[model samples]
Target: MLVYGDIETVQTVKEKQAAVAALLESVRAMPPGIARHGTLVTLFIGASELVQGVVDAGFHERGFDTLAPDQEAGMACLVRLAQEVDRSWRSGFASAPPPTGALSGLRAFNPDQIIRTRQAEGYAFYALYPESYLEAARSSGLGPDTRVIGIRSIGMSLSALVAAALGAPVPFTLRPVGHPFEREVRVDPALTHRLTSGKSGAFAVVDEGPGLSGSSFGAVADWLEEAGIPRERIYFFPSHGAPLGPQASDRHRERWRCAPRHLVPFEDLLLGPSDSEGLAAWTASLLGPLEAPLEELSGGAWRARAYADEAQWPPANIQQERRKFLARAGGAAWLVRFAGLGESGERKLAMGRKLHEAGFTPEARALCHGFLVERWHDARRLDRVPVDGGHLVERVGAYLGFRAGHFPAEEQQGASLQALRHMATYNTGQALGDEAAAALTTSLKDAEALEAKVRRVWTDNRMHAWEWLVLDGHLLKTDALDHNAAHDLVGCQDIAWDVAGAIVELDLPEEATSRLCELVQQHSGYPVHLDLLRFLLPCYLAFQMGACHMAAGALGEGNEAVRLRRAAERYRHLLRQPGIRQEQEEAPAG
Candidate 1:
């Protein structure tokens, strides 16, 4: 039987080397007879040097002759047993006619028949980029022994492509290995839904503070929708304070009223409530008529009486639900609830059962557990430490609890000016003595006032800090105000400075600086503030270029600190761009 094997060799020399190495390893491990008999062949593309190398390697290692059919740029070599070694092939070898056909002639014998009959087999490696190459191979069809290996960058898209090629699952890797493949974790939608739904629920909770908006929310919402929840059923619980007494904060209330009545406390859900009783009462009222009696347990665990009959709760599935909840919770505190069974009639369930009770609501318990777990997780993720001689600045901002609107553009500008004051004081501390540092510390107190002003201004203008940063070209320096002398000296510019200043002060290497200059030159144009652009463009350029450059050099030891400093400088420059500002501003509305 004849076996036809196909492999993709990209223009990249690295891929060729890898393929050769894999082939050698395979041959080396094979039994002596098979190894000595195996012949290496290639669909020789028009790279003469590469073809010659392969030919030379084959001749030296296995004493096999290489032949190229004089037809097209890519030719196939036939490898079979020699007549001298196998008497059965003597007549066939002597009588074989001169090869006069397309490369398809190589597949004259059925691949499946060969593999199944234990005659001949083949293996292939596919190239990574320009996916068209893989498509070509697939269109031609794959043989039974033909295992396809994908060699490329580790990205979500690449992972999906590789999985599709192998007819297997997606893969995940914490770090990239040259042409390495691994399976990805599969999320079961039905299982997730079964776990999160009903009285005791599992939710993929995401916190949306100021930083997490736009794409993040959309991504989560899309994922949830795909997971089977109706778009209309998803709720966003705003944690802003409600108005006191009669004129309560109806903002969130109005929004929630339209959605299916699922209760997440407007305040308690996002921002913990000061008055626990009032918050609980508010939540209960929001939930409306109790489909089941509310069973409050210790540690803020609670279960609503069964909304449906206990018989409908799928009795045997309780354990499955608990396991699923644990996985979803990932150790986050949570609460779980299940209906209680009694003799004939339903058992009388009381609120706030003891921790050890057999009938305790898992949802409520999970919630409590999840909170603690999340706290520890967050702490671990942050792992903030004070580094001696570190050049970092800290700033703080505050806003009025009420009266979000009222400040105008002028007031907003004035609020930003406060940052300059703090920055100046901070710098003075670095330049002067202990007396100055103490004075600067006092000046930092104005940050709250500045924050309030900024908040009012932004709220009135329907703006966010991101927008403000884009316009001004710096972070509001509130977070950086209360820093030590080391930070005051070497820290990237405070909010008071323009982007240009930051770029100039950045610590990037020469190449990164040049690359940034090139990018700015290519893209910067009319309507962009010249001074702001001039100041900021280099920083952005430097940062983008520097990161790639640093990554390239990271494997080398001894020179890491220099590279790190370069990377940091680039980062500082990029961060100084304020926020992602629009390329052009709209004309004033008529």
Candidate 2:
């Protein structure tokens, strides 16, 4: 049920400021655009991190509100920067380096871990934006004196935006430590007194989600209420309008049920007061006029339209799936999928261009507001098509080999070998039994060294047979972006992982699998690591099993859940098959 993995590093105020300085340069160099918006937002976020780093380190020695004069000035400077974003900076904003100097004090900072804001990173995911928070805060009836407590990581940036909108100075931020479902916040007596003593109209807690549990918000609210601040004075700024999930505690549930919550819904942000910048217009801006309303295609809905057998459709985690829609522009239809915003969006756009140019994926058109438009092939799923095993091997091999040769990682990313092993064992143990789990652990016993040798890349992790489009006997991969950096433990991995996936998903025979490996070597000039392939096959199976099981649990007992459970069983069965981890020499036992 818990599926999140992001690599975040601890940074000192000095370290953060240096990065901010670099980001400041990027904003100055770029013109008004998606790339610039992402850069400015990242810079703004780093500014808040730098401010919090100083306050967290020096709070013990300082009074309440916990900011020096220079720090306060730095905060005001951030507000000024934020104002530019509000004034249609996308068309044209100040082409100047953002303000700093006041926050340059390094001796005051001790390094603290900063959580990665999934919304901000790479901007290719999470449609949540700071502008939404700015709008929400503007509507809240609070003055500049409002006490804003931002949850650490994402809250750090979102809280600052809310405070800026309220004309408040240096809003305080905290990280709740403990259980995901039952969180707790710790504030010093003096700090608590300083925050509580003020006649601040209200206390605003800023963050993105109320997620499976609203514990993060609850923890902050609990900290305030325990310190004698009334619950009525505390407000929440969450991105979604959905109530907390089933995981929320009774107390946290009740608190969220009654708290004054504010947000400028995504619909408002997408459509605006007029429909000028709405999805249809956005699509038209890229590929002429649209002929139909953007047809909703998220959560594997495309499967229903593509295949006839609903019972055999692949499992898709609806809540975790990205936003997707089918946009039509006359004779040609385009699938407008959310790719991301900012640098993340740009990076994906560029990478997608490379893939499309190489004839491996659907052609990706323009990227606007974190969404990418691609040519939709009116093609059947490969599984539905009569596929020749040799042709399938050659196509999959060439595609994966191209990815390996062209997209090698400079540094290893994603879960460590040990972590992957642990996930495989733990998940298998839960679904199957300890014996089946131990089998996976045994296969991975020597993979620790393979980690050092494995060639890492941003892999196309979704190898489900249904993920491929067969347009006139040619295989084109879909959904090839952002899985390597998804909110999941799989992260990035070896090219062999994809090979393992292809073999398992397509159920390739031994001769075909070896041919696939040989074709990969021929295409990329990098020998497919047979040992690593053998090791990862079961780990890949275990991951699929866990994913399907989780989906099954979330959906409960329905036809969909039944399909998911069967998929989970199928993966379990695949893991037990001797053919899955095949090699000419000593391979994993079936």
The top-ranked prediction according to TM-score is 2
- Residues 1-590, candidate 2: write the lDDT tens digits: 22456544454445666776787777777776555665677666666556655544444344233335544555555566565555443343344444444234333334453322233432335667778888898998788878888886667667777887888866777767678898877666787887888664789998888777888999889889888888899989998888888899998888898989999886687654543466667678677877766788887788778877786576777767788889888779998888765446666788899999999999988787668888898789887888887888889989988888888764435677777788888887887788987877887798678876677887888887888999988999988987877767877788888988998889888878887888777787777777778778878888888888887887788777888888889987877763643436422221
Candidate 2 all-Cα RMSD: 4.2
* lDDT scores in order: 0.25, 0.74
| Tens digit of per-residue lDDT, candidate 1, span 304-380 | 12212322221111101111111122324222222211100011111122111322111122111011111101111
User: Residue 154 of candidate 1: its Cα lDDT?
Assistant: 16
Clash pairs (backbone) in predicted model 2: 122-344, 123-340, 123-341, 124-340, 340-370, 578-590
Instruction: Indicate the TM-score of model 2.
Output: 0.88
